[model samples]
Structure formats: C-alpha cells, structure tokens
Target chain A: MEVLGIILAGVLVNNFVFMQYLGICPFLGVSKDFDMATGMSGAVIFVITVASTVTAALEQYVLKPLELEYLRTIVYILVIASFVQLVEIFMKKTLPGLYQALGIYLPLITTNCAVLGAAMLNVTKSYGVVLSTVSGFAGALGWSLAIIIFAGIRERWKLMDIPATLDGFPLALISTGLMSLAFLGFSGLFSNLVK
Target chain B: MGDRLLVTPSPHVKSTKTVQGIMLDVVIALCPAAIAGTVLFGFRSALIILVSVASAVASEALYQKAVKRQVSINDFSAVITGLLLALTLPPHVPLWIPAIGAAFAIVLVKQVFGGLGNNFLNPALAARAFLLAAWPLHMTQDWVNPMTYDAATSATPLAGFNATGQTAFTLKQMLLGQRPGSIGETCILALLLGGLYLIVRDIIDYRIPLGYLGTLAIGTWIFGKPGAFFQGDPLGAIFLGGAFIGAFFMATDYVTSPVTPRGRLYMGIGCGLITLVIRLWGGYPEGVTYAILFMNLVTPLIDKYVVPRYYGSGHDKMARKGGR
Candidate 1:
C-alpha cells in the first residue's frame, strides 16, 4: 500500500513535468508527435528506473562509507551516462526495431533532468534501493503520462489556426501551465487514507 | 462567397442555432443559478458576479485588439465564462479574486487557445482551478453563511460528510440551497432548472449530464460510506459540492467535450470516476473542477478512438477506418 501510494503520488500528485517542472526540455522537444512521444516515454521509463537502482546502490555503498557525498552529483552523472551507453549498445544489438523507434531519444535520456532528478530525489528522500527504484519508475510514469497527454493536444494543433508566434513552444508551455493547474487538485491527495 | 460558406472547428453538425444563439441560451439557462446565488449570498455575491463578468469581457476585448483579431466578446461566451467562474467562487472573496480569475479564464484559457470553440478545457473551470492553486486560503475559506450572508467562515457540509458520511441537512434543505457552500453550488434547485432548460432548449447534450450524474449516484451509493456497501446517500452526494453545476454547465461545454454522441457519454463517465476518486480517497472534499479539467485533457483522445461508425459502412477494417 505504501509503495502504491508513492507510485500514485508520482504519477498524479507530484507529476514530474506538470507539478515539479523537470525534464521540460525533452518534454517540449520530443512531444511534437504521438509516436515520438511514446517512444521517448518508453526510453525514459527504462532509463530512469535503471539509473535509480544504480544510483541508490552507489549512494548506499560507496558514498556513505567514503564520506564522498558531495561528489554524488558528478559520480551519478558519470554512472548514468555510461549506463545509457550500455543500454544503447544492448538495444542496438538485440532490439533493432525498438532501437530505431527510440532513435536519439535513447541516448538523450542521459541528459534528461527527470532521470537525474529522480535519482537525486531518491537520495534526498533517503529512500532505500527498493523504494528508490519504485519512485524512479513512478516518476518516469508521470513524465510519460504528461508527454502523452500533451502530444494528444498537440496533434489537434495541426488543425488549429493558432497564431504563428504562439504556435510552437509558447503554446506548449501555456498548455502545460493550464494542465498543471488542473493537476493541483491532486495535491495532498490520499492524505486521509495513506497516513 | 466566403460569408456564405462558413467553416468551423469540430461539431460540424448543421444547426439552425448560431454561436450567439447557443451562447445566449446558455446565459439564460445559467440565469437561474446566478440569481439564486445573488439572493442566497446577499449583495456581495451580486457585486462579485458583476466585477467578474466585466473583467472577463474587458480581457477578451483587450486581448483581441492586442493580437489583431476580431473582438468576439459580443458572443457572450466570455460572459458565460465570467458568470460560471463567479458562481463557483466563495462569495466573500476579495472582488479582485474573481476579476483576476475572469481575466485568467478569458485571456489565458480561452483566447490563447483560439477563443470560443477552440479552447480544449472549460475556461471558467480551468480558471477556478487556477485560483484554487494560486490562492488556496481565499478559495477554500471564503464560504459565507448562505442565507444570513454573514462573514462567518462555515465549513461546507462536505467536510463532515467526508468523515462521518452523515449529513445534518435534509433533502429538502439541500434542494433549497440552505446549506453553506460556494454561492451558486448550494442551490441544486436553480442549477437543475438551468440544466433542464439547456437540455430542453437543445443547447447542451443530455447524455453527458445523465452519464455524469448517474455514475456519481451509483458510485457514491457503493463507496460513499466508509465501511458499508450501498449505504451512501446518492441524492445528497449529487446535490453536494459542484457536481450538479459542473455536470450541467462545465462538462457539457461544446468546445471542451466530445463531439460524438458515444464519446460524450464516455466523457461524463470519465469525469464521474475521477471526481469520485478524488472526493472519496484522493484529496479534497470536492472534486468536480479537477475531474472535469482532467477529463478535458483526454477529450481529444476520446474523440480519436470512440468515433461512431459511419452510416451504411460495413464493419470491415477498411470500412470502420473510413470515418477518420
């Protein structure tokens, strides 16, 4: 039940893009089309989950004993970058179709602040390995849900007569703002039951 | 030639009613709630409504002029947005709250989305949710005593109902809008009249409201109580909170709702599900605004996948795919 609460909180209450304003660059960049958005969401879910596991393990084992917690950010970044490469190579060899589908987004996950944000949040929240992985997966799900919904709205923009100036990122940002406002309803959600 | 051939967004069904006609009917339908609110919440409520409506129109006109577009404020959609937003607000809020909310509704939610018929979410509800987020203190705490119209901060009956699943007010009182709540929402009688008028006038779809209220009734009946099954008060549940007004006015907004008949049913059901989740277990005492707003995000998705089969088309894959 606690794990479920965390997942629900991440997916709806503390949404990555709408609530926390993380990974917005990729959110706005890759969410132009439906297929592309789904592809990025898939890649993000896999990468963020994996990175959370590795980062939590590292924080638990190396940084805590060595008292090198200040270097955690740099170390985590290095670890994430290398892990993404490993996934990329592995995917290219075994899953060429998915590799093609995800394209550059697979590699781009290394720089996705949401992945880094989830890892850092795990450290800050002091979540153990199991909880960290769950949080990471949940955060990735929230981000994916946002991009997918945004992509659905964007698909209609193709037919809308929006002003040229407010056509692209401007409209996207405004729409995200409105969506975030709606999501505010979920703030402190399940406070009654979870506690 | 251009004037003869009109091109509009989705909802392409031919109708004798112009946009102005439909919006005017909506205004008329909403009049009962507005008047009931003014009377129930005293003169301050009336002031709030006026300020909100004026701000909304001014914002629409100013935005149109700034953007080099035709001023569309005369259609009364902005007026409706303002009225709806005001009705949803607590009566005792500083006048500027509704004003800012009205401006936010028109400029940010409506006009920025290409104005009437183009907005993806119900502008007024979106703005209400925005205000709730921006000023939680004012939005949640400003419910004045309904008839006495005093400054006493009375918690809505929903707060107690949330915990005890019991109500002090009878069905007669809830129907008469005697309970303490947002200015307009307390008056289920007026809102029902308005809803009936809209449905009778063919200004709004019946399916959406029916599906929404129906689902809310059944869901509340099943899960409204803490432990018992089928022990919840469905009548009290629907009459409470913003459910009635939201179902009849906001959820049925043509721009934000589904176009297809079947799709609209799904929209209402989706709204009911989300509202029940939030009110029951998620958060908050009422969930109408967020339920409708969240469903607004999925309106397009519903439209995409839930299309009705074209007449005379076979059920084959190619034939089924022909409508799109």
Candidate 2:
C-alpha cells in the first residue's frame, strides 16, 4: 500500500511538473507537438530512472563512507553528464532508428534539473534505493502523463482563433496555470503517503 | 515595363533585426552587470558565469546538430540565458548548480520549446525557480558580504524583511548595493544603468518594467501599513532584490511577454500582484523569481485576452469569440 501510494503520489497528486513545478521547461517546451513531446517524455523517463538508481548507490556507498557529502553536487553533475553521453553513444550504435528519433533531445537530458533534482531529493529525503527508484519511475511517469495531456490540449488549441498577443507562449502558459489548478484537486488523494 | 515581378503576401517587410542581432544586443546590455558582479564577487563569479554561458551555448549547439535543426548557438540567446541564471545565483553556489540551471534554461526551456522565438517563459527565471524549489537552502544562502566568508551567510534585505519583519540595511545602503544579497542584486544603480542602456538601445520595451514597478509600488502601499510605503519604503523594496533586474530584463523577455501595449500592461500588473502577495504572505523571502516565473506561465493567457481591437472589427464580435 505504501509503495502504491508512493507511485500514485508521484504520478498525480504531487506531479513533478504541474503540482511541484520541478521540470517545467520540458513540460512547456516539448509539449508544443505531441510526437516530440512523447519522445521527450520517453527520454526523461529513462534518464530519471537510471540516474536516480546510480546516484543513490553512489550516495549510499561512496559519499557516506568517505564523508564527502559536500562534493555530491559536483560529482552528481559529472556522473550525470557522463552517463548521458554513454546513453547517447549506446543508442547511436545499437538502436539507430530510436536514436534518430530522439537524437536531438538526448543531449538535452544532460542538464535537465529533474534528473538531478530527483537524485538529490532521494538523498535529501533519505529514501532507500528501492524507494528512490520507485520515486524516479513514478516521477517520470507523472511528467510524461502531464506533457502528453498538455500536448493533446495544445493540438486542439491550434485551431482556435487565439488573440494576437496570446497566440503562442502566453496561451500555453495560461493553460498550464489552469492545468495546475485542476491538478490541485488531487492533492488530498496522496495525503497519507510520504509521512 | 515588360517584366514586373509580383511579391508574395506575407511578413510584408523584413527588418535587419535578426534573432542573432537581438540576442547580441541583450548580451551587450548585460555586460555591465556581469562586470559589476565579477568585480564585487571575485573570480568565482566570472568562472561560474563562463561555465554557465559555455554550457548553455554548447548544449544548444549540440542539441541542434543532433536533431538536425538549424544551429542557433550563434544567436546568443543561450548566452543570455546562461549569464542571467549565473547573475541570479549566489556567487558561492557550487559550479554544478549554475551548470544545471543553464541546461534547464537552454535545453529544457529554450531549445525544447522550439527554440529562440518559441519559448513560453524566460528560461533563466524558470531555472532559478526550479533551483529554489529543489534546494531552498542553497538558493537562499546569502554569501554576498565583501569582507569575510564566515559572515557571508546572513539573510538578504528581502529575507530579513520576511524573517524578522525588519530590514537590516537602510534605504541608502540597499539602493547603493552595499547590502548583502545576490552578486548582481547588490548594486541597484548598476542594474538601472544597464536597464536604461537596453531601453535606449531599443533592446527591450520600457512599458513592462514601468508598469510592473508602478503596480508593485501601489500594491505595496495599499497592503502594507500606513507608513509602510514611506516607512518600509516600497521603492526600496522594488530596488532591493531581483525586482528591477527581473522586471526589466527577465520578465520582459520578448518571447515570453506580451506583444501589444495593453497585453504588456496586464502582464506587468499580474507579476506585480503576484510578487507583492508572495512577499507579504508566502514562505519565501524574495518573490521576484517565482513571480516572474508564474507570470511567464500565464503570459500566453494574458496575451490572449488583452488583444487590441482590429481595425473596423466590432467589439461584440471580438468579445463573443473571446468568451469561447
């Protein structure tokens, strides 16, 4: 039940982008077109899951034993950067078509705060490796769910005669705000999860 | 007379103002503040700024090349995002913080949104907001004191106001940037000078800043105590933190802000209201970061409803259509 709650909380009530406002750049930037948004979501899910797993191990094994906690931020960034590079190279060699589809957005995963944010939060919250991995997977699922929904709305929005001033980004932002408000209704569902 | 060519109907006239030119102008305008921050904060400031700008430009270039999209790193927008994120950060913030922020700003916010003209919010402000939420201590940890690193952890003027309901620095101290705060936020005069240069160069519209500040002053006066405007000094509040820097440079980002005059006014007013509310009641000390970001999120909506009447279009027709 606790595990289920954690998954539910991360996926809906405490959505990484809409409710918590963690990974908003990708939420807004990639959601313009559904296909691209889906690709970005897939990439984020993969990165978050893998990064969190590895970072948790590093924190538990290396940083704790050495008392080098202060170096976590620098080390995490380097690790993430290298990890993303490895993923890119691997994708290019083994999965050329998949790599071609997500090629442009792969390097983008390097700097995504969500990846680091998830890893950091895992350590900060003192979650066990299993829980952290669960959080990572759920967080990515939540982000993917939110962006795909947003993209669907935006596709329909293309037909509406939006005013000149709000035609592009402004309208998208407003919709996001409203979506946030809508998502707020789910807050009560996961109230009994984390604590 | 034998062969008069016909021009296609669209984007009627082309101006010399390319994305690259606008971005270059922004970089030039930000140079003064960048220099001031470095001079005051020491070598780490320059190093952090360099890393941020480089990371952003590199990410943008690499992403474009990988995706087969047009490479836009030369346009300097990514450079602007990097510098702005660096300026907003505490000088002592770990290198990775700025690096992460830059990546968030450029790859996630700017490039992923379709790049350049397509982003919905100012990338730097969005990244700052993310960092603030993710690491409140690191984001709010003040290290701007000039003399000693030990005493560098004091609250900023805004944080002072939020925590104890009292400002340690007087109006003059705060205005002159003598107070402890973010590196770029220390010198009000420097920020204004840079802002004025941008305005003069026509790099940014003056309406957004003016409207935002004006509304903020009025809102602070009304909500605050009788002398709060004069005593706490609303103008001081406006100048103290990232308000001016954010209002002029970050909030008025062309892609994120409104296009028409009226839309811009609404955008400014919305930001002012949000900032004031958060400052007075929210958990955070400084609200400019979230205020600008929240407004950036709503900019699209503001532009939608605040459109000017088309020539000869009936008001009723527009209203009926808008109501849908």
Candidate 3:
C-alpha cells in the first residue's frame, strides 16, 4: 500500500512535467505529433527505469560505502549518459524500426533532465532501491502520459484558424497552462490515500 | 508570376529580424546590467558570467555538431541564455554550479528542443528553477556584502521582508541598489536603462514589459500588505527584485512568450497575479523568476485563445456571446 502511494504520487500528484515542471522540453517539443510523443515516452520510460535502479544501487552500495556521496551528481549524470548511449547502440543493431522512430530522440534522452532529475531525486529523498525504481518508472510514465495527451490536443488544435501572433508556440503554451491547472486537481489524492 | 507561384505556403512576408538579430539585441541590452554586476561584485562575477556564457555556447555548439544538426552558436541565443542564467545566480556559487547550469540551459532546455526558436521555455529561467530545486541550500545561501566581505551572510531585502516582516533596504537603498541580491537583479536603475535601450531600438515590443509591469503595479497596489496596499507604491514593487529584469528581458523572449498583443497582455496579467500571490502568501520571497517561468508555461495557450480580432471584424457576435 505504501509503495502504491509512492507510485501514485510520483505518477499523478507530483507529475514530472505538469506538476513539477521537469522534462518540459520534450513535453513541448516531441508532443506535436502523438506517434512521436509515444516513441519518446517509451524511450524515457525505459531509460529512467534502468537508470534509477542502477543509481539507487550505486548510491547505496558504492558511494555510501566509500563516503563519496558528494560526487553523486557527477556520477549519476555520467551513468545516465553512458546508459543512453548503450541503449542507442543496442537499439540500432537489434531493432531498426524502433531505432529509426527514436533515432535523434535517443541521444536527447541523455540531457532530458527528467532522467537525471529523477535519479538525483531518488538518492536525495533517500528512497530505497525498490521505491527508487518505482518512482523513476512512475515519473517517466507520467511524463509520457502528459506529453501524449498534449499531442492529441495540439493535433486537434491544428484545425482551428488561430490568430496571427498566437498561432504557433503561444497557443501550445496556453494549452499547457490550462492542462497544468487541470492537473492540479490531483494534488491531494496521494496524501489523502496515505492517510 | 513564376517566382510568386514557387513561394512557400503562408508566412509569405518575412521580417528583417532573425533569431540571431533578436538574440544579439538582447545581449547588447544586457551589457549595462552585466557591467553593473561586474563593477559591484568584482572580477569573480565577470569571470563567472564569461564562463557561463562560453560554456553555454560551447555546449550548444557541440550538441548540434554531435547530433549532425546545423551548428547554431552564431545566433548568440546560447550566449543570452548563459548570461541570463549567470545573472540570476549568486556571485559566490561554486564554479561547477554555473558550468552545470550553463550546460543544462543550453543542451537540455535550448538545443534538445530543436534549438533557437524551438525552445518552449526560457532556457536560463528553466535552468535556474532546476538548480534551485536540486540544490536549494547552495542556491539560496546569501552573499556577504561585496564592499565589506563581512563573512556574515544576510538575507536579501525580499527575504528579510518575508522573515521579519520588514525590508532591510530602504526604498532609496533598493533604488540605488546598495542592497544584496542576485548579481544583475540588484539595480533597478540599470535594468530600466537597459530596458529603455531595447525599447528605443525597437528590439522588443513594448506590450510585454509594459503589460507585465503595469498589471503588477495594479495588483500590488491592491493586495501587497494590509497598509502596503494603500501605502505601497506599485512602482516600488516593480523596481524590487528581478521584476523589471524579468518583465523586460526574460519574459519577453520571443520563443517562450505570447506573440499577439492581447495574448501578451493576458500573459502579463497572469504573471502579475502569480507573482503577487507568491510574494504575499507563498514561502518564497522573490517570486518574479518563478512567476515569469510559470507564465512561460502558459504562453502557448494565451496565444491560442487571446488572439486579436481580424482587421475590420465585427465585435457584435463575440459581445453578444459574452453577454449571454
């Protein structure tokens, strides 16, 4: 039940993009088309899940034992970068279609900040390995969900005869703002459930 | 007729302004504040700013090169992002902090989103927000007075107001910028001078800054503190903290803010409301950064919904709908 609370909180109430404002670059950029958005989300989910588990284990077993916790940020960032590179190479070899869809976006995941932010957050908040993995997976899933929904809205929005100034990026930003406000409705759900 | 037929769909008329031009204008506009920061904080501040700007530009350039995309460092957008991020940071922050911030601002917030005009939020502001969240203690640690090197850190005027319910700096002190705050946000006079230059050069439209500051003034006049409401000069509120810097430069970033006049007005009003709310009630003292950033998230929506009516379009239908 407590783990469920963590998952729920990370996924919804404390969503990485809308609520916490992490990973907003991809949230806005890749979200123009639903198909691309889903691909990016899948990539983020895979990277975050693996990165979190590795970071948690490394922080707990290696850094803490060596008293080198201060180097966590540098270490976590490098790990995420290498991991993303590895994923890119592996996907290119084994899964060409998936690789093509996620081609440039794969490298982009290294600096997504959400991935690094989630890894660092896991260590900083002192979540155990299991909880850290769950939080990371949930956070990525939440980001994916938010961006996909936004993509759908933006696609529909293309039909409207938007004004001159507000036509492109401005309209998208305004829609995101409204979506953020709507997401605020879930703020207390986890807290309430925990009690 | 052949050439006309070959023209691309829409955006038929192009402005003289390119992203490079606008970004260069901003960098020029920020020169005054950067000089002021260097003078006030000494060589270290200048070094930090240069490092940040260089690192941001380098990171952006390298990222584009590595990805086999067009290298866009010449646009000067990365420099502006780095400068803005450095200006918002504490003068005494660790060397790695600014480097990290610059890299993030350029690579994560700017380039990864498709570079130049593609970024949805102000890269500098987003980097600052991230640093604030990740390292709150380091980011929030107040600096000793540059003149004294007093070893004892003191709260900023805004923070002082939040804690003790009294501002440390007098209105005059804040106006002259003798008070301690972020490097560039200290002197209202400097910010205003730079802002005026931008306005005069026609580098930026006045709608965003004017609307932002004007609405903030109105909101502060109404709800600033009990007596502050009546006694509080809205102009003072505008001058305090990074309100002026953000309103004029950061909030008006072409890529992140609304393009339409009506959308800009609505964006300004929203920023003002959020800033006032945060300053008055939220835990943070200076809300301008977050307020501007929060509003950046909404610029797309504001542009979509608050579009100006077509030239010569009748308001009768809209007016009747509103009445109903």
Residue lDDT tens for model 3, B185-249: 87777888888988898776788888888887877767665554454457557766778888888
What's the CA error at residue B187 for candidate 2, in Å? 1.4
Tell me each candidate's TM-score. 0.93, 0.61, 0.63
lDDT tens readout by residue for model 2, B101-179:
8987787666654566655567887778767766768877847674343347566767656434345577776667776
Task: Write one digit per residue (lDDT tens) for candidate 1, span B1-324.
Answer: 112113333546776877777889999988999999888889999999999999999999999999989888878888999999999998899999999999999999978867776677899999998898889889989888777888755678887776676688999889988877887898999999999999999878899999999999899899888999898888878887889999999999887888788989999998998888888886688999999999999887888788777664565766667865
Q: List the residue pairs that clash in candidate 1.
A: A190-B282
Clashes per prediction?
1, 8, 8
What are the DockQ scores of the candidates, in order?
0.74, 0.03, 0.04
C-alpha lDDT (0 to 100) for residue B159 of candidate 3: 56
Please state what fraction of the native interface contacts candidate 3 reproduces: 0.00
* Residue runs of model 2 more than 4 Å from their true location after superposition: A1-17, A20-195, B1-14, B147-151, B163-166, B225-231, B312-324
lDDT of 2 by residue, A1-195 (tens): 778877887886679988777888878888889789889989999989999999999998999999999999999999999999999999999999989888788898887788998898788779878889988899889988888777765653464333454456766676576456434434454254533
lDDT of 1 by residue, A8-48 (tens): 88899899998888999999998889889998999999999
Candidate 3 RMSD computed on C-alpha atoms after optimal superposition onto the true structure: 13.0
Error of 1 at A16 (Å): 0.9
Q: Comparing 1 and 2 by lDDT, which wins?
A: 1
Which residue segments of model 3 deviate by more than 4 Å?
A1-195, B1-14, B149-152, B163-168, B226-229, B233-235, B315-324
Off by over 4 Å in 1: A192-195, B1-12, B313-324
Task: Give the clash total for candidate 2.
Answer: 8
